[model samples]
Target: MKKNLLSIIILALLVVNIGMTAFMMLSVMTTNSQTAKLISDIAAALELEANGGNTGGFSGSASGNVGVSNIATFGFTGDDQLTINLKPGSDGKAHYMLVEVVFSMNTASADYATLGTSESLAGMRELIKGKVTNTLSSYTIEELQADDGPAKEKILEEVQELYNSNFIYDVTFSSVLYQ
Candidate 1:
């Protein structure tokens, strides 16, 4: 009787251990699968530039001179530029226009199209242009100069709305020319 009880206890313990190990393995597999899926999703969303090897720089100095590096090298992949004309404000001082913009889509192939389909890209371009125009119109020259935080937020919100996805990872001011 004693021997039978001992055997039953050991068997129960072994079964429990095996069950726990299997559960852990399954959990690990699930976690890894999810991670891989997330990585693929992000990669698809980025449409990462093939020429990420290219490093570009831009300077928005107080001197109103815009200097761009790598702009010429990369060339124009999509809509090349966004130019806005600002009217002098009511204060009679020519206020610098705040134009926030993103560079062209890094679409090297159909699989790497960041801006989605051509139709979506067209709509997004128009939406972005309109948003930038509207956001800039609201800011005075002083505000543009002083509060970069709000300006950046406005740009992000507009871009996110325009893209209809969180795909626009960043919004960079390609050029800030005050005329």
Candidate 2:
């Protein structure tokens, strides 16, 4: 009788351990699937924005009667126009102006063509916008339009840092209009 009871107790503990392990595994799998779905949704939204499906969806809330509109439109191949409405940042005493920038990839080389062939335009668009926004926000209007080559080089470097993918070689700005 003692031997039988000991065997049953051990079996029950083993069963419980197995059940707990299965539960943990299922939880991990569910979390991973949810993360993947979220990433997919973000990618789709970026693609839609890049392809010019809906520009108005990107707008942020207006503050102090100052609205910042994100007017983005696809231009020619490899080119995009982004209009940003600027408002005074916390300090209500700065001159706020809207800036519209049209940026394009310089696809004038054989290397560029090879890179373009490998990636979809939508992915490239997402990559470029992230790079441009990070780099351009630091400069004043005067610095961005400076005739000196260093300013342009700096911009390109910033883009390159963001995109280490071999598919992107250089970035060019076709237009920068400030209002």
lDDT by residue (tens digit), candidate 1, 1-179: 99999999999999999999999999999999999999998886554332121232111111121234312111112455545544465577765543436543223322225555656666556666777677776766666666556765676556655554433334566556554
Winning model by lDDT: 1
Candidate 1's C-alpha runs over 4 A off are 1-80, 85-90, 94-100, 103-115
The collision pairs in model 2 are none
The lDDT for every candidate, in the order shown, is 0.53, 0.48
Off by over 4 Å in 2: 1-79, 85-114, 145-151, 162-170
